[model samples]
Target: MSTIESRETSAISGDAGLSLIELIIYILLSSLLLSAMAVVLVNSWSTQKDVASVTQATNRGQVIGSAIERAMRNALDFDVDDATGTELRVRTSLGGNLACQAFLLKDGDARFTTSSGALPTLASDWARWENGIAQYASTPFFVENGDVVTYTFDIETDSAPVRFSGEAAARSTATGVSSPCW
Candidate 1:
């Protein structure tokens, strides 16, 4: 074969495939890129999970806070128990005989119970943190100054603890009304 033709053929063959070292380098680079992508994916998932947890905690706090505020605003008379200072007794305007008690259960469940008779039935679970992992960091309490009442509480979750506080004004006209507390 001619020298020029032989040289061209050799060059083409040499360039046809990667050497062992080049192949190893390529594989290393590809693995690094995949690893980076995997790290980014894991970080993104972690961030999303944190955001969802915070949002859920905030929603629960808002729901419970709003309910307590609404009930307090429509209440005739409300008192925080002197014994534990965690139990709030409220006489609601729904009826002169209707009364509600808000307290934290032994297992950290915040509950609301209404009674007009001998037995006080569980009306609702205001905040349920009874699974042990999640719980009420602080039981709800009320600070009453004349007609204005302030409520404050905290709920602990996996991500963080959520705090809630609000002020409500009792119905002035409903004052001095009698309600049954069982």
Candidate 2:
């Protein structure tokens, strides 16, 4: 009976507290697991940011490119505004006699706005198609071959640049002078 009691007491004490080695091992393993999780979280965040940037650039490039193509395909008259081919104006079949649509690249951004019979005199009239364009990667220009017109644009992202190319034809030539919209 005495031996049995001593054994029971020893068993209870053995289960009461962890040895120092056991405690230290548990702490070390927990710290290692937590640090690994933190690293995974940081990597996931960086990948998400890059994906968002690329998506934004691609969406902007596609929307702007398609709009220009559509306008040219149904254009009543088309003209380039400047010698550098940076500005293009289209008088669409749907537009009023004194209205036009202007597309241009300025200050490293692709911009668009409506105009009266002539182009707007103030730069404030223009609005950006999207936010934050890399100036070095952008080259928005027009190339007209007879009735067919071609446009090209390069939209820059953090990873790679998106290139847009479109070609279309106008219904007729301009009835008046060059820079007809202006």
Candidate 3:
């Protein structure tokens, strides 16, 4: 064969395949890249779960806060039931003899019960948090002075507990009237 042909054949044979060391190095690099990617994916998923937990807790807090504020605003008179500060009894003129009682259940849920007429019996839960995901960290309480009523409580969640507070004024000037449902 010609010298040129021999040189060409030698070059082709030399460049035909990768060395064992080069192959091993490539595999290691690929494995490293995959590991990094997996870590990043895991971290992202964890962050998402945390965000969702917080959002759910916040929404639940808002709902409970709004309900309490509405009840307080419509109340002609109200009483806080126990030293634990978990119970509130509100009487509204709009509902006639009907009254609302908000209390914390044994399972850490907050609920409302409404009753009307003389010799009133226990009623169904008006607003209940029974999902078992969110709970009351502290008993809810009210601070009343003159015509203003303030409600405050803490709701517990997986990530962090949220504090909810709100104030409402009575629609009528009549205060200290005896509640029929008492």
Candidate 4:
């Protein structure tokens, strides 16, 4: 064995993997990194949940508002048989007789119901019945001049309630195309 070989052997033997402090430091650093990642993940999840709630609430509100507005606006002709606080019977050019109204379900959830043609037909003529809607706390829907319906809507959401108020006037001036349906 030469001097160089002996020195190499000693160096190799003296080599150790890691000191205790180095191992502990590495563990602590990794723990801190994992904690940071966990915090970020939790915050991201919370923000996403909040955004979803707002989006759902906004969508519901828009649907309810637009449906009523469109029901009054888009009619080639319409008749207002009964328009009240919690009930509306407006036969539009779209939904025929026995069409639409706002009422509470058996479980107390308020909603709108609309049908395409008269009932007793085959394919479910119900266009779309948006649920989770309520009359506004202060003032509900009321009729003006027997053709314009003014309403305040309350949309139920998981976080909080949303409200919208507007007045919709029927564009119809037809004489007696069809008798009004309830």
lDDT of 4 at 34: 100
Q: Identify the superior model by lDDT, candidate 2 or candidate 4.
A: 2
Give residue 56's lDDT in candidate 4 (0 to 100).
82
- Model 2: weakest 10-residue lDDT segment is 131-140
Q: Candidate 4 residues 1-182, lDDT tens each?
A: 99999999998887747778889999999999999999999999988887787688678767666777777764434443243345444556654432433322111244455555432222133334556666665464444455677766666665667766777877765443433433
Q: State which candidate, 1 or 3, has the greater TM-score.
A: 1
Candidate closest to the true structure, highest TM-score: 1
Better of 1 and 3 by lDDT: 3
Candidate 3 backbone overlaps, count: 0
lDDT of each: 0.63, 0.72, 0.65, 0.58
Off by over 4 Å in 4: 1-15, 74-84, 93-108, 115-128, 134-136, 141-146, 174-178
Candidate 1 per-residue C-alpha lDDT over 51-91 given as tens digits, one digit per residue, 9 for 90 to 100: 88777777876776676677777776676655655556677
Model 2, global lDDT: 0.72
Considering summed lDDT, which 10 consecutive residues are worst modelled in model 4?
100-109
Off by over 4 Å in 1: 95-107, 118-140
lDDT of 3 by residue, 47-151 (tens): 898888778878987776776667667777776644655556667665643454454433456666666643233424355654432324453466656677666
Cα lDDT tens digits, model 2, 13-61, are 9999999999999999999999999999999998998899889888887
